[model samples]
Target: MTATAPRPETSGPPALPPLAAQVERLVALGVLDAAGLDAARVHDAVQAVDAPGLLVVDRGLVPASVLTPLLRLGDRAGFVVEDMTDVDAFAPTDGLDVPPSPVYVVTAPDRGDDLGNWSPEEALPELAARGRSPLLLTEGLHWALQVPEVVERNFCYMTIGSRLRKADGAYDARTPAVWISLGTGRDGRERRGAPKVGWCWWRNRHTWLGFASGVDRLAVPLDG
Candidate 1:
């Protein structure tokens, strides 16, 4: 039997860029163009927010389904696994209330590295009791877009806030996650070091996987 290494100190505030620069990064990635949005208008919407966190276009406007592919770390692009082609159908699970705004700020987002190896079943309620919310899949992507280091080796995190509802009305057991690929199995050698968007069973624990969460979410009105 092998022993797992002790967890390191949980990371401090994410290295997110300023609000205005975030918009420019989005523009450079063609996120604004894909959503038929103008850079100036998008910049104006969240200008009033002076906090340090991720600036995300609402999933309604630029669904994670559409934006995940645009995520890049170094020269490696992000991707969803083939088994999850219907990723868009995974909505915010019951009890998660994402605001109805075209844009929002994920206040004080952390990769939750301290929660690594805990199953989603164990992590979700833990987040709630702490007055935090698990980061949605899109939110995780936003973090990677802004600060790629958040998806580092041996320090990845899950996004259990989103789930797919079966026709029988029960939620699917697969919980989404973000991590770096070793380029093994179906992930080709060419994909080594790429940022991976995938899933894990809700009941399973992974030594390298944590539960990503945010202190709170604030709806940043486009009218601002």
Candidate 2:
């Protein structure tokens, strides 16, 4: 009998952007309100969380814990982490304005591939825990069929991606989730041949797909 060849191992470590570098890029985009940053905390977060894996969306309150680790990085970039809760509940929200730049990693909290993997049911509760009521949002192309719960929230979301298509020219349902930023994107879209939105250069890409109930726009008020 002929011996069978073994299959290659699939999946590897996530290639998330470097924390310090990503913070700098955000400053260049002019989204973060990098001022009066608690420098002490930024230093601490950088010292504590060294790996990119620690920042990717996962089952934990990393946002609350790790959000301030880059105060110096952000302060230098001219963007400060506001006292707002909702926008940064799921991910770090840069800038200090209503609807401040929300950095959504299309990478699911459980998986690392694309945004489609996450459903409203799975992500909403966490947002609520953080006191957010923004409409569940994602890439507009697959909105209607994928996340119908968007009607329950106030505003839609817009994010960037590179892993939605497959060899068969259909949506790659099995594809992993990716991390997105309603606020600022990563440093290498062209390098990876990713399909960015029309003339997008930063991570603060707030293109809402829907809204409702006296909510005229996507707003992230700083009540804290």
Candidate 3:
């Protein structure tokens, strides 16, 4: 009989570390997992339990269930816990209004080809002509949001609510108001788990968002 090649094993999303790590980092420290928790829920959790520090693990983007708890924890702790997801969270009630300015987009130079939906480099030239900066938003997790001062020193984009407004100040149709840069290639290597920048309210699957250095503020309207 001829030898045959063996099939490779398929896999699901990577498994996280043991639950103990979670307990030690969050439950033990008196910190709550605020990223995945909602405000009132977080308040309830805090009131129910006793701890010192909180650690919220976002398996993916920030969800309302997760954010509400963090908000409550922020109220109790006097500071917001770190957001582990690659995107930021915002209040849904807040309105989305683009000031009359130039919009800048940050993206990876190499992976832009694979991003069939959007192109940062191609989009930036016109924006720059209007005096805006096109930054390349990078990929990372919770640690990235920690250095607000550094982010502020580098990028030009701003985070806002998901709802969009028209010229008359009325609500626009509830489209997927946010856009996130998933990555640039078919292999998914360049964009997997990359942080996105967009409105906070559009937390559903279709919405996209990105995270950029705080220093590079956009001068135009970023529809995503």
Clash number for each model: 0, 27, 47
lDDT digits (tens) for residues 146-210 of candidate 1: 77778877899898888989999998999888888888888788888888888899898899998
Quick one: how many clashes does candidate 3 have?
47
Task: Report how far off residue 196 is in candidate 2 (Å).
Answer: 11
The window of 10 residues in a row where model 3 has the poorest summed lDDT is: 105-114
Q: Which lDDT tens digits does candidate 2 get at residues 59-85?
A: 131222232222221122112123222
Better of 1 and 3 by lDDT: 1
State every prediction's TM-score relative to the real structure: 0.92, 0.24, 0.20
**135 in model 3: Cα distance from truth in Å?**
12
Off by over 4 Å in 1: 1-5, 8-14
- Using lDDT as the measure, what is the rank order of every candidate, best first? 1, 3, 2
Candidate 3 segments exceeding 4 Å error: 1-32, 35-56, 59-61, 64-144, 157-224
Q: Specify the highest-TM-score model's number.
A: 1
> Whose lDDT is higher: candidate 1's or candidate 2's?
1
Per-residue alpha-carbon lDDT of model 3 for 69-123, expressed as tens digits?
A: 2221111211121232322222222322222322111222111111122223232
- For all candidates in order, the CA lDDT equals 0.82, 0.26, 0.26
